[model samples]
Target: MALLIPASFGNLAVSRRAHVSLTVSASANPRTFHRESVDWVKETASFFDQDKRPIMLFDGVCNLCNGGVKFVRDHDRNRRIRFEALQSEAGKRLLMRSGRAPDDISSVVLVEKDRSYTKSEAVLKIMEYIDLPFPQLAFFMQFVPLFARDSVYDNIANNRYAIFGWSESCEI
Candidate 1:
């Protein structure tokens, strides 16, 4: 139960200048990741400094994921969290940058400063950035071992689509 899951895409070529320019960015067409197009995409779409805010990349089409984002957005009193649909170019790049598979949208991803968190760790770390009760709750939950926490997370994630449905396109 590591904080970051090893990226399925091994030895992905790193791009030096991919940056997000907007608070949130979403795209209709999911493109095949290409290293040479990174600079070109930066000029056209949203890419920015990861240091500006914590970016949460999630399953764009999953109803549960979208609902979760809405929940975070509502409770995030400081408004410090930024979001990018995992289907979006910005999200894909961020995933690659964090050494994650760009196509793997099974778990939520939280990219903050120079580190990345996934699964239960990502969810809990995100709670730390939210309002009073959540931060307190997250602090208490930290005492639980990672393996146990991630087991619950995986169960929910694996069954999310059946329980919550999915969308043809990303709405948030």
Candidate 2:
């Protein structure tokens, strides 16, 4: 079961186990994942305490997703972000914290400063943390409406597998 909460751009479906105060933007269709009973707020707090850097979660087996992660790693001269595969334990926990199903890999998710950005918002926000020209480019792209940006994003994401291919196993 899920509780629907009104959000700025879309409705948020929060899971019963989600206790963290996370602002989710441009999320995908909601799905439920079974979670073991635990104190989620405390767990997330301790995890973030260990590392303050923002986390980027992606589809580990998708070639395009892996390429994007590599791009961020190479361009992020400051190394301000950490990465996790959406199928990994850490990624699953973060997804649950943000009220997303662990098995849902429809879009890349960025968790930073107690908020989550998904779909096109995650992509642009990621550019902001990377190298110089990308940030400038992202700033300019903000002029485009969210719906338009996400429409293109969804198109690419939906076809990523056929266009970019996928690996048999998760990597990086």
The Cα local distance difference test for each model comes to 0.71, 0.74
State every prediction's TM-score relative to the real structure.
Answer: 0.73, 0.76
Which residues of candidate 1, in runs, are more than 4 Å off? 1-51
Please count the clashing residue pairs in each candidate, in the order shown: 5, 0
Candidate 2: list runs displaced more than 4 Å.
1-41
Please give the range of 10 consecutive residues that has the lowest summed lDDT in model 1. Answer: 16-25
> Model 2 residue 85 lDDT?
79
